[model samples]
Target: RWRIGYAPESWDACLNWARARKIPEALLETAGLVVRTDDGRVYDRFRDRLMFSICDEQGRVVAFSGRILTADKEQAKYVNSPETPIFQKGKLLFALDKARRAIIEAKFAVVCEGQVDTIACHEAGLEHVVAPQGTALTEHHARILKRYADEVVLMFDADTAGQNAAMRSAEPLLAAGLVIRVATLPGEHDPDSFLKANGVEPLQEIITAAPGFFTFYLERLTKLHDARTDRGKLQIAQQIVEWIAKVPHAVLRASQLQQTAMKLGVPESALQQELRQYRQRDRTVATPAETTAPAEDPGHPAETLLLQLMLTDERVVPLVQQQLAADWLSTGTAAELMRKVLRLHAAAAWNGHTSLLGADASDEAHRLVTRLLEEKRPAPERIPAAAGDCLAALKRAALERQFQAIKLRLAQPGLSGNEVTALQQQILDLRRNLDHIPRLSVWRSAKP
Candidate 1:
């Protein structure tokens, strides 16, 4: 709400008033109220326009958005106040001062894509409406909404570009820990046009029917990728899991995992396992000095492949668990992850890794799960053999570790004669067991 007399719109008028009132030049310059021309003449920055006062949440006017009064090819359509001491475009949301209470009472906020859209929604009786000032929705906007609203519905234009914009806004909003929904109008209509054509009732209906953030993401990505083929389905699953990782709530993510599995026609267990990995990748930060690919851990292939087999066939889990001891799983990051998976499975909290919806998994565990999800699934016929081979490999590694420990113990001078003999015999037995174990070529046979 810009008041007409708050500031003079003409250069001469402002100059005359300032001189008559003895206003300081430095104060006027610092306020960004006037522009100095090429010839050293000062002029009013805003003139003959419909000015909209932009205020902070405390209801103090800090800047303005001014629309052109008359069409001019050389003139831009709109002009905004330059950044000043009190104004930063990214930090302000238009109409927040007026909409705060309404948003809190309603328990939701309506975020339109532009200032006109915000104005239209407000006049149409939707009071809890706000808009970003000529920029994409930022984390600041999301933070502002999070303060007064449980959810924020995006009511951008119903066009391809508008849909894209809404989608883009979703990540920051979710990252800010706010529940997001999308209100898509029919055809090419925007909030303003829809309200004009169908009035507030229909417009409200559209908002009421808006999909939740994850649901909107699934629908949007589904259209972009064909899920009829296995590869398409896998790709869609990866995208959905990645998006779900953006959701900060593990409970919410677990529920979305089921929905994603059903939507992509993949196993819920596989998705659950993959969700862990996706979350890990989302949390990963790379160093600026590193340019080459990250070094691959030698144990990852076997460990992940074993998890993949167990993910596809739950019956192998018990047998795999029996062969892997707590000390054996302490060998590598992958081994440690498998230990958690085995422990969860034993407690009935994990159903092929997908059922542990409530278990808070670490980022490293998630990264491992995601890698497994992307790998080729073992053929149904080969699962048994692959599981057996992986089991043997795990066992042999465990024995070899034990044998090394025994030899290290034998190196100490404090060891008794009987203790040294016992250690040597145990080492011999471990070596014999290692020789009898099968070579697990499970990776070669598990190709898609």
Candidate 2:
């Protein structure tokens, strides 16, 4: 158990308590239990607060997170002890010392966004809960979690900041090759309030029903963007492709692409082609190809599609080659890539993309080289029809552009009542006009 205790209203209470026990005042300063002002006065670092000891794996108290009692505007809601010899905030997860056995038994860890939520879960018989104290979930935290469990369930608040934290956390977990699921509380409820409001069973039920990272994020993207139109569909597809491309394994990437394409009602070949283009373009950039929440990318999706088709399909490669004079593409990045792919094929140097640009590509070229070289890829004649679809997507994109414009206006500080209603109605009409993309609710349940 953590060394749960309290500090009184008066700053001197801790100092006096230490003196009565004959604990040296200098030791308190060194331990980060007290702070020395520039004017030479010494006082407790955590006053009028509930103090929870942060412990190491051996259950040694190395730091403290102090929760303030009042809603004081000037002060932070929580205060933590400064870095000391034993504790580095970013390097430790709260309650891990106590949660280790429970985590091992559960075979999965629940990561909460708050220390109080961690305590609340523990009290309600969910003993495997932990929190990232004073920092976001890091690679260090991921490695630590992997020691006890193979998966992490992120029980973050429904608020924007908490949801964003949950999203950011998936990276380190994936990079560490650990399975990640996200569980959310309704409305403005944090885990502590949700537990008290609904009791443990309902809260536990939600966590048990949390979805894997892909299903979780894809559903979120559906809500945030219109899935009814071609533009919206491609936007969502591009975002999913970005994250899928980041997956460290090739076979895994292909499998994810197959599943995503199925869900989007698109050909697996198209998504595979999209990912191939993402890889080629990603290779040339100096910036890290990190995928956060998918935002709008204005890149021409059709041109990239053609380029990818060329890279993988010998049929489509000549289609792009014959029409090199026309410029439907905005950037030469993908065009240059197709040319390289062509030369690679002609020279019989058709190795991986790494051979040309020192970058990794999807497995379609490697896996289906026999199909491609044999001229057996699907629908090479429809390459021109795709141009028609791009033109139609442009027409439909006007609605998407209008929808996004309304969203931008909604973000502005103040608006008149009629303006807000008109905007809301426009969104309602757009929603009705667009085909409703079904959200996935069937998720694998964890142990209750």
Best by TM-score: 2
Could you give me the TM-score of model 1 versus the true structure? 0.59
Best by lDDT: 1
Which lDDT tens digits does candidate 1 get at residues 112-137?
Answer: 98777888888888999999887788
* TM-score on alpha carbons, each prediction: 0.59, 0.61
Instruction: List, residue by residue over 30-126, the lDDT tens digit for candidate 2.
Output: 6788888989899988888988888865567788888888989888888898655445566688988678778877889999987889999999999
Which runs in model 1 stand beyond 4 Å of their true positions?
A: 1-21, 37-41, 71-74, 282-448
lDDT of each: 0.74, 0.71
Model 2 — TM-score against the truth? Answer: 0.61
Q: What is the lDDT of residue 353 in candidate 2?
A: 40
Regions of candidate 2 where Cα sits further than 4 Å from its true position: 19-26, 287-448
Q: How many residue pairs clash in each candidate?
A: 4, 0
